[model samples]
Target: MARRGKTAAKSNPSRSDCSSTSNSLSRRPSSGDVKTDLLQALSAIAAQHVNAGSIPLAAALQADLKDVLRRWKQEHASDLQKNDKYVYPLEGRYDAGESSIENVARSSRDPRIDISLEVGNLSGADEAVVRALQSICNELGFAIFLASVERARKTLDEEVLDEAVRLVRVFLLDGGRVAEHVVLSPSEILGLQHLLPRKLIIYEWAAAISALEGQGQEEVPAELSAWIELQLLELFGQVPKLYVEDGPALATVLTPRRLKDIVSVMEKFAGTTPALISFLLAIHSKEMPISEETRQAAFKAVFATMLASFDITQDPKDVRMKANEQPYRPRSLDPPPKPPRIPCLDSDSLVQLTMHVIEDDTLRHELSLFTSQLGAQTTRINPLDFESLFLPFLHSLALKTTITEPHHEDLRTLFATTITAYHDRFVGPTPPIPPSEPDVADGSRRWVRPPVRCTCAANCAPLNAFLADARRHRIEFAVGRQRRAHLHQMLDATPRTECTHRTLRGGSPEALVVTKIDWDAVHKRNVRAAWEGRLKSFGGWMEKLVGAGVDLRAVLGLEEYERVVERREEEAPEEGAKDGRAVAAAAGELRKRKASEALVRSSRLQNAEGAGRDVRRRVAETVAVVDLTDD
Candidate 1:
């Protein structure tokens, strides 16, 4: 869904995508004289970026910026000369004393600093303008910093070989209808990546993303947001060399009192970007060892991060590594842990609750998915597993749906991810399909997808019913690469049971609707074997029995059966009367046979039952087998 470098560019600015990632979403900033506060925040961001990268200036270009400054000063001299007392006051770059950041943190409505300095007292016009210009510079790298300014942009546009300028001036500080600055589009940004330092663009946009995330909006270009988060973490991983060099500046701009809050917020935030997550943790935890509780989580996260990176969760080496690590650690509590719930899920309870899945008409795929994940450890799901797995999965699932709307495409994805997340504790690692592969068939064959969604159709009931049957019957998915190879050695591996149904297709009298056998499994296991040897021409043998004066109509009477079967336009439902038709006919035969006749019939029944359940208990088994249905 997202690539590393390109993500930020693809956040389609045209769509009204919510870009807010406010750390404190519920708490909104109140309206008032927030002018100074807004200015301070803006100034801090601007300074961080301005101080970040190379100020591109060749001898000629340096002279050009100076020339512009000289001309602007000259042009505005009349205005500057007139406003000697109070106009065009050169603002000073903020000097952060020990308590300056602290004081800023505690700022109420009015900031203590005097904003209206006399223009005459203002010493450095170039410096004040440069500092003010930092916000724009932070936004625009110095490589093209002056290109968008009124005079410079006009000059640059004439010779314009470039598709766009790095910065676009929406309006100017000229007191008319002008925007101070606007960021370039992604395409424009990429064009300039080589021209400007990557950090300049990274830090500038990172600050914007961080600030926007603080604004309580969601639904931005997910790829872009995710990329920024990851890159922040990536840079985080490289903390000391790049970021630590700015610690003093950070301390000055952010404040000592704000450290705890910053760290706390970052601790939670870094989880979004694993690249920086480890370093964020290491930076904070370098001095203080992680608590036992946090350690387990850290391991799981790091392990999953590694798995994601290498795509090797199922490797034997990984399993051994996981085995060595402690899986659970108790969290510290004010009081203590609560007593565990009792009345473990009984077989009857699981069965009874499971029936709802088979019978219910109202449940959605989300419910189906959630229910399936909850029972992963035990097909006959423990009710406690519902509380443990599904309940928590539902919470995240709900958050992903409502909070992270665009990401929650399938319910099964939520379920599969939940199962994978807790794989160590709850569902032991089974044959985990790759995160890239489909765990379930979307009902249609697909090679791979994110874990949760398997085969899916519009409706879930039949699928739900099928899964329930698999659960009840203890259908083990062949585990490991050798599972297929091992199948021949397991049990008779031959069909013993009679099928429960005979299915006829819609609009065709001769179509076999349902095989009554797990043909998909059978075909994969050994298709040729099904028709090989003794099982071949079992149909012809059945006809021979009927032709040899063995009155099959007496046992499988054409009258009642014809009347019952003809009463439908479409095929009968699963587990309908037809499901048990083969068994009914076979039983009928047994009942009619006398002891001596039964002994003689044993070999045939035994032979047929051994081939396939469908062959014996269903239409394929019976002498009166119909090739197709007339709808």
Candidate 2:
């Protein structure tokens, strides 16, 4: 687990507890006291350090003392300088040996005011040096330095103030090497919030909460615990903004485990911050477009966090009680019955062939028997039959078509001669040159020729015509070769259904694991919903802007509308012109039609009394027309 720093208490300090003083600084300074009282407070702190035998701290304090005296000199100017009693000479401010007890009371005649004069000289020097001085001062006594810093905060730049706040955290929260316990109160830590980095503050809150929780049921400081809880609640307010502006970048910095911890802490103290809820909605609502990896990681992080919340351990009731358990009893068992095994004939020809090749007599006999049975049940054909029968018939048809359809004589002759020559050269002799002695009485022994042999039957002429035309085309030849090879492969291949063995018995159990969730679908849905919501929100804002008289074109770009017009013209200028003309024509036609209707209405009214029944009927029809128009 990553360690987060503890937060300071959120409680406000009471006016009475804000300050305390020594005899040298006897009066509790009011807000109106300003510079003089602040200087006096510093002097008192220095005196106190010197009395406590912390020589190093006293020396560092002396440096601060001189800074106050010098500033006072500048502020007082000639009034103090001219009054010898009021002013310590300029040279005395630099030299601590000559110093401030001459004007003010001291516990010793020569208090060994061993101060690092260099620190006073380097007050306006390098920032690193200044910070080092602050850290040293913080270690000596946080109270005095914190008091001095609080008083001087207005005069300090952010750099110095940031350094001061960090020192306070280190000293107060970490308690340094010398401190036995936390040296600063939660209120003091909280007061430093103005100067502390927000990033540091949030982490400190997390760390403090973790520590409080680490103690389990033990008593904890109420103020500290409250501070941690408050910080956690407050931190959630920024989490959504952080994720939205730079979720991927932020994800790189934070581990899934760390995110889960943060989420867990938020849930424990503050049900859920609105910003965090919005962030989760954005992550889960597939409408928000994020990278697949990022979405998956976010999902995994949520899943892991939620899974961690479940107490998967066995329940107390579910656990068997050893005290009430029955003892195991040894018993004699009957001999196990053997399961009958039926022989499963292997379908692979290679296995059988290998057995025969190795001169296994039993396997060879079984293979011979299997082959004879298979041959008896199945019909077989020969490749040589196509060469002897089909090719000659197709060639003859092509030749016949060339003679009958003389328009394509050259092309048909070219196809028929090419096929005939190809068959004669590669496929040997044509029909009547039988593979074996053909029976004279029965032609069944000979190769079957087309008409009856063709699968297309009466449409064999069309088939021949197509084949004749296709044979001359280059693509057709390539296609035909491919299809022929495919057909051969299909015929030669063993069917899977034939491999099933109903005679076989016995089986082995198998386990299959499948997930119920479709993560891809979930991620897509989230992204889509988030995007749609965003679009709707944007659309509403856009509508408001347009309603307020903001021109979209001007807002988007000065020439946006012009560019759109130009693009439209470029794509289909003629189409646009035609549409415009059509609209104008339609408008003119509608106007003419409306004028005619008005004329008819006026004529009907004028003739209503003169034409009696016919005019009244026409007027009534006109009234019906008016009613329809009104509707």
lDDT tens per residue, model 2, 258-371: 455445443442311222222333344333334565645654444333233322122212211222234455664964454332111111221222223224333333334433
Task: Give the C-alpha lDDT of model 2.
Answer: 0.30
What does candidate 1's lDDT look like per residue over 1-631, in tens digits?
0001211111111110001111222322323322222223223323333453333322332222233223333433555432111011112322223223434454333354222111122223323333333333233222112112110111101211122223322211211223333434322232222222234322232333333332222344675456555554444444322121121112111223333433433343332222222222332333323344553443334323323332111222222221233446577656555555432222232333323332444434434553443334333334345444343334433332332233333433433333333322332212211122112333332211121122334222332344334223222232233432333222223243222222233432322111124434434334333222212233343344333322222222333222221111122222212347775666565556544554654566567533222323433333232222211
The whole-model lDDT of each prediction reads 0.30, 0.30
Q: Which parts of model 2 are misplaced by more than 4 Å?
A: 1-197, 200-204, 212-217, 240-631
Supply candidate 2's per-residue lDDT for 254.
Answer: 32
RMSD of each: 28.9, 38.2
- By TM-score, the best candidate is 1
Report the C-alpha displacement of residue 110, candidate 2, in angstroms.
Answer: 33
